[model samples]
Target: MTAQSAHLDDELNLKALSFHAQPRPGKIGTLVTKPAATQQDLALAYTPGVAEPVRRIHTDPDLAYAYTNKGNLVAVITDGTAVLGLGNVGPLAGKPVMEGKAVLFKRFADIDCFDIEVQAETPEAFIETVVRIAPTFGGINLEDIAAPHCFEIEQALIDELDIPVFHDDQHGTAIILAAGLLNALELQGKTLEEAQIVILGAGAAGIASARLLLALGAHRDHLLCVDRQGVIHLGRPDLNPYKFGVAVETNKRTLTEAMQGADVFIGLSGPDLVTPEMIASMAPRPIVFALSNPVPEIRPAAALAVRSDLVMATGRSDYPNQVNNVLGFPFIFRGALDVRASRINQAMRIAAVEALRDLAREPVPQAVLDAYGLNALSFGPDYIIPKPFDPRLRERVAGAVAQTAIASGVARLPLSD
Candidate 1:
C-alpha cells in the first residue's frame, strides 16, 4: 500500500475505535420500556400488576406477546467462528459485531435486539443453549458462525423453534443477490434458467445463494461452485454434503474454465482471485457480482475496463449496485415479527426478492438520492438493486414477506391491514 493509503487506514482504525469506545464501552444497552419511578408505578411494573399478566401468560402462552416486548424483540446470537473476514475471533471478540447488528436492527426497522455471544465447545451445545432461551424473544438472528456447522446449527434451530430463525450471513446475502441478479439478467436480455453462472466460494453465503437461486428456477446444471479445490463438480472426491448440493457433472475443473462463455460470475472469495482475462472471456453483457468486501475479486475499474458491457456489483457502498445485507435482514425480521410467523420460509424469501427486484424498476425516490448525495439514479445496468436507504424498503419488502407468510400458512396471527 502507498504511504498515504496506509495513513488513511490507520486514521480510520483510530476513528472507529474511538466511535465505539468514547460514547460507551460498547454499542448497545437496554432501555426500560415501562415506568418504575414512583412507588405505585414500581408496584404495578414489578409485583402486583406484573403478577396478573404472568398469570394470563401462564394460562395462554400467546398472551406473552401482548404483555411483554416479545413481539418486537430479537436475539442476535453468534459463536464468532466466522466473524466477518476475521474468522474465528472467539465469542468475546465478536461481541462488537453482534452489537452493531443490534444497532442496525433498531436503526433500520425499529426492532429491539439483544446481542448474545455464546462460548460453546460444540455445535450441539450451542444449539441447545439457543433452544433453551428461545422463549424470551420473538425471533432469532444467527450471525458469524462458520459454515458446515452454520448450516447444521440453523436447520436444527428452525426445526426446534416455532419463531423465525435466520442466519443473516447466509440468507440475507442470498436475498439481495437474487434481487440484483434478476434485474441484471433482465437488462442483459438473459433469464436465470439459461444463464451460465459461476460462484467462486463454497462457504455459507455461496452455498445459500446457490440453493435460493435453484429455488428461484436457475437450472442446476447451469450453476457452478468453485472453492479452493477449484470447481466443485460431480467428479470431485472431497466434496462435503453442502458442496455436493450444488455440484454438477461438468468438465470445467477450475474458475477460469468455469468462467469461459459464462453469462454471470459471483465471487464470494478473497481479493484479486479473478483476473481481467476471466472478465473478458465471459459472454457479451456479462453480469459480475464480485461481492468480496474491502476488496472485490476483481476491482470494478479493472473489470469495467475489460468489458464495457459489464453490469457489476460489489459489497462496497462507494460503488453503484451494492448487494448489501442491510437491505434485507431488518425488513425481513420486521415482517416476520409483525405476523408472528413460524419461520422465514422459502415463499417469504422469494417475496422479498420480488419486492426488491420490482422496487428497483421504479423511479428512485428523492430521499434516497439525497442520502447518497446523488442527483439521480435510474434502474439500469449501473443500478440493478435498490439502495439501502430507500424508505419504501420497509413497506415494500416487509409487506410482501408478511403477506406471503400468511398465505403460505406459516403465520400464527393474521395481519390487521
Candidate 2:
C-alpha cells in the first residue's frame, strides 16, 4: 500500500544511534518494584521485613514466586560466539544484543529480563554457570551462541534444569519460519509435504527449521540443506551431528542444484549468496524467505525482477512479510512464564505456529494498521506473518503456549486448565 523512500536507511540508522546514545548509553536497566521512598519503606524492602520472605523461600523453594520477581523474570544468556550477523564477536561484545533481547521481553510481553553474557571458554562451563544461577529467574532464554555447541548447551540445560531453557536463535527462528511458511504455502496452494524445499545454511536456524517442518509432515526426501561446502548430503565428510542427522541421501549436491524447480527457499545464510537466476529457476509460484539479517540472500526487488509469481519475505522491516524473531520469542516466553512451564516443548511450539498462522488470516486491527501507516493489510503475499507490535500477539501466542503447556502436562502452576 505504501513505498519506502530511498533515504530511509540513513534516517533509521541515525535515529537508532541517537536513541541508543541518548537513552543513557544502553537499552535497559533494573526497576525497583517495592517502594523505598521512606525509612519505613527501606526497612520493609531490605532489612527485617525482607527476612521473612527470604526465610519462607528458603523453607519452600516455590515461595520464590511470591517473594521475589522470579515468576515474571527471564534471563537472556549468551556466550557471544554468534552475535547476530557479526559472528563470534566474543562475550563482552554481545552485551548490547542481549540487552536488546531484554528490552523486547519487557516491551512486548510485560516480562522482565536480565541479560547475562558469559565469558566461558567451553560449553560445559557455560552450562555450569547457567545452572549455578538457575534459581535467579523463572526461565532462561539462550541467545546468539554458535551452532552445534548451542544445540548441546541447550540440551544440557533443559535436561538439568527444572526451569525452561530455550535457545531463541535455533527454536525461535524455526517457530517463526514454520508459522510463516505454513501461511505462505497455504496462499500459494503448496503443502509442506509436497514442496521441494532448499535451505541455504545448516547452522542453528536451518537445521532446526528443517527438523520442525519434517515434524509437521514435510517430505524428508524433498529437502536439501546447503552450507558453504554445498548441499549437506549423506556421506558428506564435514557434517556435524546436527547436520548429519538431517542430511539424507539426496541427489542435489550444491545450492544451484538444490534450487532447480524447488517449491520453497529458506535462507539463514550470508548476504547476496542467492541470485535472481536462482530464484527464476524455482518452480511456479515459489515461496522465498531470505531471512539473513541486515542483508538477505537475494533482495526482494532483484528476486521479483525475475519472477512475479513468487512470494518473497526478508528479515528487514522495510520489506513485506518480515520473518522476525521478535514475533516469536517474547510472547513465547510470556506464555511459558504464565503457566510456569518446566520446558518449552514441541507441543507449545506447534501451538505457537498454529496461532501465528491463524492470526495472519484474520482482519488486521486499526492500531496495527496505524503502526505501519498502511491503508490495508491482509493474508496475502505481502502479509503472511503478524507484525511485532500487534497487540494480539501477546494474547494469541502467549495464551496458546500456556494452554498447550497445560494440555501437554508441562505446566507447574495452575495458570491454565
Query: Least accurate stretch of 10 residues (summed lDDT) in model 1?
Result: 22-31
* Candidate 2, 1-417: lDDT as tens digits: 124654777788899889888958989988998787999999999897989998999899999998889999999999999999999999989998998999999999999999999999999999999999999999999999999899999999999998888899999999999999999999899999999999999889998899899999999999888999999989798888999988979777889989999999999998999999899899999999999988899999999999999998999998999999989899999999998999999999989999999999999999999999999998899999999889999999999999999999999877743
Best by lDDT: 1
lDDT of 1 at 10: 99
Q: Which regions of candidate 1 fall more than 4 Å away from where they truly are?
A: none
Candidate 2 has an lDDT of 0.92
Clashes of each: 0, 0
- Could you say which candidate leads in TM-score? 1
Q: Write candidate 1's Cα lDDT for 308-370 as tens digits.
A: 998999999888899999999999999999999999999999999999999999999999989
